[model samples]
Target: MGRMMLKNWLALLTAVFIGLSLAVISIVPPSPQGLDTPDDQFSSARAMVDVRMIAAAPHPTGSEENAKVRTYLAGQLTALGMDVDISASTLPEKALARLNRWSGQSKTEQPIYNVIGVLPGADRTKPALLLMAHHDTVWASPGSADDTVGIASILEIVRAVNETGQPARDLIVLFTDGEEVGLSGARHFFSENPLRNKVGAVINFEARGGGGTANLFQTSEGNGDAARLFARAVRQPSGNSAATYIYRILPNDTDLTPALKGDYAAYNIANIGKAEYYHSPKIDADALSESTVQHMGSQGLDLTRALLSADGFPRKKPDATFFDLFGLWTVIYAPVWGWAFLGVTLLCYILPLRRDMLRKDTLVGAVKMVGFMVIGGVVLFGLNALSGGGSGADYYDRLAAIPRLEAVAGLTIFAVFFGTFGRSQLSENGVLGATLPLFILAVAGQSIAPTATYFISLTVLLCAIATFIRRSKQTETYGQWISAAVAAILIGYMVSFGHLLMLGVGPDLPSVAILPAALAVLAILPLWRGLPKRVVTVASIASLGLAIAIALWIRLDPIASTVPLY
Candidate 1:
């Protein structure tokens, strides 16, 4: 009984640690106290002033509100002790026709303005660091989160940088218009403007929702040098190569598109949560998450400061494999090194089995684990379809349903575990069997997409080591401690990974989170032996029932005014 009690306590302790990790990393930095009483510093409080003014009304391209925003932005830049230039162009005739047909308006032309401000460095010879943000909102939406936060962040970043000292190179701020209709403003600036030649690096801030962690999601091709700079410069960095690879395949568009075409290093960062408020009529000053604003500003300020002070911008190099360690520090290596990790995991699994002589029960357990994952994936796909997923569903509506969708997915996985593993006892050999499929999947992932598979391969390697230790004589206590530690790390990493996966592809591919979730659950299987069957069954049913009710609520909820009219 004492041994069983100790096992249960370990389970609880692991869960608490996982929760603590999530809570610490996911929080947006608090608004600085000096914001309102600004004294030559960049503060979200002061930035909020601009966000309020820009997002006070809908300011789509060609609208009077957009013109007002342009004039206001020009005035603000002028007050910042810089010469602000406004480049205005008419929308191409063909694009105007398309917009007319889409909006059912007979408008034949639309005007766009690109605002550029130059704060010359003490030395004028080096290439400039460019800061980019759009200034227009989607039609009928306040758009405080989408680009207003970005615009406000740039203004604040400049304010803070100026207060520190004159930069080593020219600091250019490009606030482009017509971003809502398309990337017209950014395209015009990067393609036609002479200032494009002066730029060596670019940092673009963006948003997809009203709140969530701000992810550094994209970097220039061959970003090894640039990523290293970022990892060293930014505190509490949140990024991974898997996100970069996925973004390459996604059809998403941002102002960074035209910049990427140029010979300049670049970064794209955005927050994606409370997504129902993205581009919605309800996106106002109060609707915006101040913490989200602070988060963006904090990251932008740090990177900008580092770049401005660097001896020279990072030159192009081979891309690096990088991931954050519990949001504390970034670990980077050459992509080719992923093979070493995969080899270690393979050896750990196979050598242990060889020593134990490959029992048949172990093989059976491996098969069952794979079967469990397959069934879980199928259940998630079906539930997602029922929860207004699939191609026919409105993109924004599906985004709004993410919270519910996450719950549904979680409950389904829990239920599957209860019905399958809760009733059965897995001998030591059976436990070894479960690792086989995970090991195979990790190997495949490492070979095909090393960056994406690190979470899988690394966790398996840790668990395999613990398993090996457990098989030793008179070292069972040591093994349990190591296992608990492994579980804690895996669980923490997976929590952040799951949230990011949902944010990046939640509307269409939430089921992908199951891969990490399953691995995390299996990692703690030893402690779970003490978990009661009745407890698992009841919790499973309750969670599933709640998930279904939430799904129904999502379906029944009317289209919020926050969603786009089109």
Candidate 2:
């Protein structure tokens, strides 16, 4: 018995290590490159980038704050003494008429404008490589991030070329309006575009939710002809972040999308239906990729994709979020998921579900161990929360505030035991045995100091383990499974909402697995306990089939994923 206890304890240790390991990996901020610092290391490229920043200052067209951005772009273009053409191409008639037809509604949408500056080439009729940026933003807060930066970038590049008094393929810098409002500016521009035939290529810049996690992945479809040229010419060693770099091609949504065409259908198409979007990392993690589109479209270009992102994951630091987990935020759902996992093991003991090597009594003890483990965690959490000058935020926030995943690892340990404890049946001894492992996971994440959400989840899962240990049979009834099912549905239904709420898997995979399994278990319980075997079995199977079929449909058949920008 002592040896068996030791083995389970070891397994618990393994799980804690795995969970905390990932947590640590996430908080690892990469070493900042001494790239182009103004003091001494500033390279010519750095100088160019900095100068560009000053020239493009604030061209946001969405709100009053961003209005300054637009004024700045105009001012910069005027200062350069170039032939500037401000094309009111965004809110043109035909596009709005079509938008009204598509959204199944209509209103006098804003007139989209494009600030077009043409610098004629030597033998000028060749389509020029136009530079583009949307003069708009996500919120009324400030367009400084999403596009003020992009607009400013265009101004610097265009102005620099103008200063040389030599045009590179007839530079046409278009500071587009209504880019947020459904590529109205772009769609309007293309409606009768000479630039389409003449423009050889384009360089479009985009700002995410934040500033400066510098990266530039190719966002165009034309292989990489001009893109490689720019990258090679603009070559400077990229910034390094110590953690995972989530640099996959985001399907069209950012301001760059309008320009890219498939990406803006504007930016993409303007670059002749194929172009690249210069991007940064900050926006991807928390906010504003879609806000730019949604905010614009809501004024009624009917922005959808950029209004709402594709993966719907918690991205750029959004304006506000509902991922508010009060007390049991962190650990609450982990167990909800963990219970499914725990049930798999416990089936060996109760359902005679599967043949496994782990002893039945040990499994039962593990399920029952939540109480002892959580009690220990409560004390630890209280002390740590107290000791750390705990903010009015979750563990993830505090951890992130402190900025290290390892700092919050201890809390994660607490949640991990919540998992093992959920699997084991309640027993006084079992609770005692589970305490140490739970403490370990919590301690690990706590050590890393995760983001507010991460730590909160960690804490909730820890408490859940404790609750399980104390309750002994939380899942003993059909009502419990029904409750679990409801929770799963709500959480799963909102996966696309992302950080707007804390329920991620609550909306996707867990709900997929849980909703049906929960319903089936609830429906079949009466039969398994003594109802007519045939009647119960048939009803259970039908219910399972229906539930799963619905889940499959939701997963497979996407309703409004690809929205038409035109």
lDDT of 2 by residue, 282-312 (tens): 2221222322221111111111111111122
Which pairs of residues collide in candidate 1?
280-562
Question: Candidate 2: lDDT over CA atoms?
Answer: 0.35
Predicted model with the maximum lDDT: 1
- After superposition of all CA atoms, the RMSD between model 2 and the true structure is 19.0
Most accurate candidate by TM-score: 1
Candidate 2 accuracy as TM-score: 0.38
In model 2, the worst 10-residue window by lDDT is 269-278
Model 2 ranges with Cα > 4 A deviation: 1-72, 89-109, 162-165, 222-227, 237-251, 258-566
Instruction: Encode model 1's per-residue lDDT on 260-292: one tens digit a residue.
Output: 999888999887778888888888888988877
Candidate 1 regions with alpha-carbon error over 4 angstroms: 8-13, 16-24, 27-42, 98-104, 350-357, 530-534
